[model samples]
Target chain A: MATWLLLTLAAAAADFQDQDKQGHPTRAVLLGGSGEAHWNAGASVGSPWTTVTVQRGLRGGWTPLAEVQAASFARWQPAVGVGKRWIDRRWRLTGEGTVGWTLQGDPIPFRGPAAELRVKGGRAVGRFAPYLHLGMRSSRTEDRVETVSGDILREEARWETTLTGALGTGFLLTDRVGIDIGLDLPWVHMPNPSIPGMHIGVQTGWGRNQ
Target chain B: MHTHGVSMVRTILPFAFLIACGPPPKGVDYRGTRLAVVDMHLHPGDWQQVPESTQGYLASRFPFPFGLRPEQVAEGVLTGEAILDQLDDAAVSAAILFAVYAPRTVGVATNELVLRERRADTSRLWGLASLPVDRWDESSEAALAALSEALDNPGMVGIKLAHAHMHFRMDDPAYFSIYDMAVAHDAPVYLHTGTSPFPGTRTEPEYTDPAYLEAAIATHPRVQFILGHMGYDFIDQRPGDADTAIDLAVRYDNVWLEPSALGSRGSDPTGTNLPLVLKKAKTAGVEARLIYGSDGPQSPGFAADYLERTLTALEAADYSVEEAQLILADNASSLFGIPTFKAEK
Candidate 1:
């Protein structure tokens, strides 16, 4: 459903703020990396996570993206998808959908396919862009079902879901270089439920066309 | 050369991190005592019969490298022998095998399985029977009958309930009859309090808080209420309802505090919560009411690790050797009527 919605938005939305007069996108490739650390209130830091992303703007307000995300200091999940962003002057809105695999989820209790949907809205004030994001993530892991005699009759699939809401501000130090910091509220599904976390990142790319 | 050495150090660090799988934990001193070290919480399940989600949770927490999961180790292995070996590794005297019926959360470890495993070393192993409450509305009587019969076995020492995992309210009177059965059979009721990290467990204060059980605890004066986890919310690492549990223990003779699973890295990775709870229990002067349980045999070295963690916390909490003995062995021995050396004479 998220993918379909993203596709519909991409098709219906026009790049009024991002396209040149010839109807070509002005934005280019972006490479971003982020590190997340839990807010343990000074005693000890909880689960540490990192993510790296690549994005390229497409025509009609669409952007194609791929990312690798590792979490809890040991688990890794990589996803790829497309997004649509709308801009009216300094105001921005984005919707994206991604699918990935739990490449390695030790200490996270899952292994297999996963997906996410994110919607972010932000407004720029000079060099800083403040944003609010809401995201929904779902993943699948497998288990064996056995009869009373202990024979594996079949493999059952268990799906786990969690939500994330974040508020962050982006700093554009230079025309093509930027930094981002965010406070993240992630609902971790397996083992434990959730924890407070924050993220810091740097990205290099073309400035958003306006 | 320095750059090459730095790269080598980086390569070795991740490998070291991934090697959380092996180098089996060595047994430690049981506080330099030979008193009966009874671990009252052990979930021994047949690998084939236990749910895969449970296996996943165990494997995820105890990260076995090269895809050799800890949950797979017990396959075709002797369940009882494996449990006894775990006890030996942890330097514990005996451990109770609990039959869990949490079909919604961790899956079921049937009473039959618990009985079958206890036969491996009846002298050193015990069983705690639980009723299957999934269909309790239709089969409460039959389930009670099965529970009654299981309790009749000499090895079945108590009743086990995880209301959070079992999807029941504490004040719900439909299950009050279980306490009546416990009173009649002279069995203590060991119930899970506070929060569980497992998926599908109810985390509401209604289910996880022991305050909801206050009325029941008051009414069932003849029934001993051993609150498990000492109200430690494992998922959140908070001292959940420990004050209420301590108050109950102080207010009523039948109420007891169990500190099982409070020492696990999942629950208290910094080793702070357990000491805090132990200090409070000490302040309340209910050291004798504190029973030791590991919630153990979770993974390869989890039992040993949890035991070591608990001991470290006890030391940090300023518990003496004798108090440690009470928490570790003597108290449970007295509660369950397990014959110690003095009793055997």
Candidate 2:
């Protein structure tokens, strides 16, 4: 995901020809929500246990664009793929779609290639912005349950998906530096191993155009 | 002339735009202002249980009640649901969880299980793995290998050792193996010094003396040592016998004191007696050397409440608020390498 994010950013930079009237690409640092990925808990009876998606936007726009990401948790393995973004800057609206394969890590019920969508935006206060996001995500999960007689009776695996939402605020310190605090509803489903539910994290990047 | 003017205008344009943009509004320090319950000593309770499935197949199992099964014999053991309920009811945001079994005796199986559980529950659980200090014959090699294995695990944030269980003094060359291991891991060691309960426990009131640790610290300059039980003698001994322990922790730059059994179980071991230790830590000007710890199952319900009460009692006994915060959170965070308590904007 990082490699692809960087590549896309490089492509964006190559696109910026430094035209005389281009206004220097509006280089403002972004410390806002990355709604490109929506985390979901196992709500469906036959879905993966947990799913996590981390992605970045190489450029800003209101139309769908290409992206890369890795999704995993439980039996699910980390997968990399191409994605698209949809944005409506006026009301701070944004959405994303991605497809990738399970690259590495533990693999079980999970299969290759996953997809996601997110909508977000609120009020932008100069260098800081607060946003709300809602999204749906899908993946696969697997487990090993032993028998009473000490035998491996069965391996349970399934492709699952969930709906998630979060509220967050971020600071755009410079064209390349930013920070964000988000509260995500880890699992929207029941009967799943409760892990990595609600998380608070900070991310910093350099050479980010969005 | 026109091109020169344009270049100058471009330089000023970005500056003018930045000035017009102004600065971002400052957010409140939510964590600092909030009343957080800091339980210093806690363990991932379920991991203590011997997995029934793992045991059922065996012809004979270790006599120890392993697994989540609760027996009336011990007040500290709790079921999985009950353990979660305690935190849910307490509004606790942080806890320092440590393993109780001597790593050398209990082996890595139990410690490994505990670490896995703590990693899965990071927000409320900070796990300190037990170091294998029971085997003193080859103390250095055993300590190094055992601690290295436990510390290599990312889930393991710190090292835990009990002088009583290991039968080694903090100063003994035999135990320096553990110190060397902890230094290599870049994590803190929660040394079980001061006092213990079991009869014939190696750390007697005299040998458990905190001074023993000074030379070790001098030799192992990089190790960060946390004195457990507030330096209180474990078995019945003279009152305030841990004075030397307190003095050493206060005097040493690397030594730390955790309010574990001291505030709840010690020479006068009771919830009420906790304040005295806090007072001593303050009077000694080593308040900042103290950190939070529960020594659970060893004590009762006071772990969650002691942190706040200890601070209040210290102040009532003439300690400063600054001293209280240092003991409750700041020092522990610094000593244990807990990034959560670091200052940030």
Candidate 3:
């Protein structure tokens, strides 16, 4: 399926102009959903995690994003981030960072403050772009979720981390609209880690913002 | 662009349908040995009652993920109908549903809900009563009264306790009276006997060690104690108390070793430890004392996957067919008196 999609995308790219090199940077707002299967993690520990994201593309290749992730809708983690992108004929690359909060759920012992850093790269043809993303995410969990809202008397904590990656293609419907779809690959807390997942996103923007 | 967008939807729709409509779960094929399955450990909860942490965990347990919010999906699956549908999908003959009251951790799935669900009429669902132990000193009497009442009902087979999640110590003599209640009711006790990853659970040996309950096991010999998770420490990711649990089961006849959650990817990615534990039980000639519990329904098809995982582990341990039957179905049936299943001739 992936091979067929990539071949089609390559064929489409051949007919389109390199607007990435000639036109202005994209400034768009995006909304999307993501899902990952953690059955491989541990039946008790891994929940089919689904996440929703909202993003704002800023001027001069800067972007800000926010998201809420749910582990089977049982737990929720919300995060905010910013990234910078560099585009050319062959690749559209981005580097981003974010901090996430485990607001409620079992926390079993405590909640979490998680941090992530990611990089994405892709190429565009006409309105289609296929990208690959790679990064790292880390979090601390224990009894009390450290938050801005409350006081903590004592904290017992541990660290968890994962290597994050994704492969997807984006389609620009018009000068102001587009969609992105991909598979997310994360190696969580390795020796053993999590498996690949899926995400879909939609966006609208002012094109060629010179 | 509109055409392209339409095309994109058309392309993705098939994938969505595929996820929504998964292949019917073809449950564990017992080869030639006809073995019925009774899943001893499962937690059920309401969407509103579940803590966000638990809600997150519940979201992905099912096989499908589309057309609804994650919580909405969980809310749907938590229902009696959905539970039964899931059970059918996994080919589970019957299941034991636990009533959870750990508000600080997983949240509540009340005893009343367990009894109220219509699934009880189908005989596919059974109950394990859980009491509110967070306020032990203040409400122990009322809690026991409620528990006793719950146990009096049909299909209420056991008492489920989590020393770690309920913020209690196993050896706290003050709480040991609960065992006396177990003795009177003829209900077996299922205790969470190892470190849990859930926040707020007590991880110390006092709370999690299977050895901590030896005295209680001895004192209440009439009351059976089924050690849950087989002292598998999920947080530390080691076989935390498997040896102690196996030792206790070997030493004490009233104790039953339950190796639940040992087959999970998070606990044992290589599928290594459970087979060893099974081998140890067979070696010790304690297979009859072993009861099978998947600790599942975690993700949609997990109950079936866990059963298959466990049965595979049984094969890995080289457990003979008779030992497998004892561990898989016979032991649970002997204790609960649930009706039996004979494989089709």
Best by DockQ: 3
Which residue pairs clash in candidate 1? none
DockQ of 1: 0.07
Tens digits of per-residue lDDT, candidate 1, A1-210, equal: 999988765543332222231111111211111111100000112234466766665556676678776655456778898777655334566788899987554323568899998887765554455778788889888966677699998998988776866676765554445566776666655444344666776655443332
lDDT of 2 at B226: 77
Order of candidates by lDDT, top first?
1, 3, 2
Candidate 3 regions off by >4 Å?
A1-210, B1-27, B31-34, B50-70, B73-77, B118-121, B134-138
| Span of ten consecutive residues with least summed lDDT in model 3 chain A | A34-43
**Candidate 2 on A62-109: residue-level lDDT in tens?**
222333222222233344333333333433444544454433232112
- Per-residue lDDT tens digits for candidate 2, residues B200-259, read 356554356666677877787678877777666545533244566678776677877776
Among all windows of 10 consecutive residues in model 1 chain B, the one with the lowest summed lDDT is B62-71
Most lDDT-accurate candidate: 1
lDDT of 2 at A19: 28
TM-score top scorer: 3
CA RMSD per model (angstroms): 15.5, 19.7, 10.3
TM-score of chain A of each: 0.70, 0.48, 0.64
